[model samples]
Target: MTDIRRIWFGSMSKTLREAPLTTPNARKGLREGVHWRGVSAEVHLGYRKGKRVGRWLVRWRLPDGRYKQDGLGAADDGLAADGVETLNFEQAKSKAARYVEQERQKQQDAGKAPIPTVREVVEAYAAGRKARAMKQEGARPDDAKGRLSQHVLSHPVAAKRLDVLTDEDLADWREGLGAELAVSTVRRIVNDFRAALNGLPARTLKRLPATYPMTVKLGLKVGEAEPAAARDGAALPDADIRRIIDAAKAVDKAEEWNGDLFLMVLVLAATGARFSQVSRMLVGDVQPVQSRLMVPTSRKGRGQKRSTHIATRVGADVIESLRPSIAGRRSADPLLERWRHRQEKAKPGARPEWVRDSRGPWKSPTEITRPWAAIIEKAGLPVDTVPYALRHSSIVRCLRAALPVRLVAQLHDTSDKMIERHYASAIVNALDDLTAAAVVPLVDAERGTVVSLRG
Candidate 1:
């Protein structure tokens, strides 16, 4: 038999404190609200719609043999509850008792509040994530905001309240996204939206269909198709790479673009570094004496905030070409720089008006795309080839040279797992020659026959 006295607290703070009602996890298995015996009524600590702060309600037995209930205040779950507005367990019980004593006389009832919409939740989630990212060392908060704004906030389902949102509604919206976006892009958007939903109250989250709330057990199905980078046209041949570099030099020389496109393309190929990483390199990052270039850590993905560099060795001739950029310049000077310009409206064939001379580091990777298109065109490469192909080609070159996967990963500033995942074909080709040395000739000594197994 269970002790009724142990289940209910009466004028005792210790009883309320010791009960499994303090933490969210502890109260998860309990009913909607945990009750305690209060003066002339029962004090109930009610959990909210989501994992938000708990609320307090007082239930009284009326003389007509009916129960009357009214909300008192919020329970102190996350924030410390003050006696008047927010109340602790003991304070809540006392307040509930007081409210019941007064309310039982008048028989008053509390009205229900409005529920939050999906858009509201997503906005709050984005703001909180952005703020935390600003404080954290290496978090990409802008990416989070971008995903939510472009996908969730713009969707029709954002207007639907959590209480009314159904599995079908979520599926409709997700499918709509898939219709316009790539499989990989749709997957990322769905993931980001799911992360935003995690901030909702536990109860509301539970109300969502187990499979459709983007939970792994019952989530939306995304295709596991091979990445575009794994295709045959992803990487350029070594002959094409050389031609591209030569063509870049020709374009820069003829167009008088100050060798910016040429140097940028050279460093990108030599280091196998991303455009963003190479654009951030300083004059001091180029070590002429050591024939190496130090690429900085990327700000795109999640990692530790580091000032360290990934040292990549290049040819002596490559280092020689970089020496002129370092001549009589500060170590902090950008290695590859260009003259910044604004498109001023010119009167029919007339020279454009003057703007400020701002020679600084490249602000974005998009700045190089136009020049890269021209370089590729001059090199007679495919029109569809992107600058990212250089990174793929570089990784393939190292794999072709029989460099260890771990060593290649270190130089390229990515994981061996990623390299293996994207470049397995290149890896298999490298292994074929390496495994050839271990092969031994077969002998037929038992049959007293001399035959070559090499055949």
Candidate 2:
């Protein structure tokens, strides 16, 4: 008994706005499109393959030739047969039907084109990026790009819109993908969406979610300082770190032609330094007096000109690991020159184009993920863990020891908030040890209810 009318400025049906299957007993083509107020509406049978099923599914073709479909499947009367639905027929379709009419009344009469949904926008954006990147470099992004798009952008969570993203939405998504995908999967999705927002030029960019909504849901982390930091793609643990290092050490030429891939990871694990820091460090950047390695400010992170500090433990490890090739070299030497030279040389020679420096430049952090990932897989470690996790692990260790996150962030060169969001509960166990160390002596030496402590 729903009112059905034709929507048109003239003789043409123009667009079918409300294609409603009003009742479980409704007949399509019996009533065709109906109108509410000045708007026209109708319901069309949605078909799947050869099966013509009657469900809540309807496509509202607005005036400007644009359309939006009701995803509700034909499972219920007047629903589509696709097995994908936003609403079920018998119960949800009628309610959905009302909106169809409302939309026509509000929009179609204006002769305006319909706006695209979140799914359409994301598809367009991703496809747009793919086209641009292909044309710009005549190639795809490095391997990290492969992992991200395949797992994060194209999977179940990809179509979620920024406005629709909720904590529950992300949490459910994180758990759903957790078993099938790597931790990096979620991280990469977050990064992809974030990059899409930040990197793409558009007025709608600001409306996107600034961080992965799951950051809070995955559990809190112990950062160098903050109460939260979002976890990333994946990171190797200490054992895997050791394994990767050993495998690299045993590679064909661990010496002379350094295994830049493994060595870079080792350096990140030990120093928690960002890729730019590890790559750009010159022999002279290492100061024995300060026990620090100074590199230029990175374009990533804070985006300011400042030095990144590599802790003594991490710094010493990198220096010792790289000592063989660098021992007799002068301060003018680049720390990573030899490795870069050897890697680029591994490919077939097209003849030498000398720019004076055999090691042309150190790689950015983003470029270092691929071969290191290969090394991890070869070493029988999880393929998901990447180099940045080294910094997180290092931060985790420091956090467990009750080292302040402020100090950790200061040392590691990232935000404290980023640390806390990603670190796991295992950090509590680490912190417990520090707490125990703090209290054990006090408990043992108590002369009164509480012993006086030295200032």
Which candidate gets the maximum TM-score versus the true structure? Answer: 1
Candidate 2 positional error at 185, Å: 1.4
lDDT of 1 by residue, 246-328 (tens): 99999999877787878989999888898778887899998888898999877655768565689889999789888888899
lDDT of 2 by residue, 230-306 (tens): 45334446686677777656552533334555565666676767665666666776665554556433435435545
RMSD of 1: 12.1
When summed lDDT is taken over every stretch of 10 residues in candidate 1, the lowest stretch is 1-10
TM-score of 2: 0.44
Clashes of 1: 5
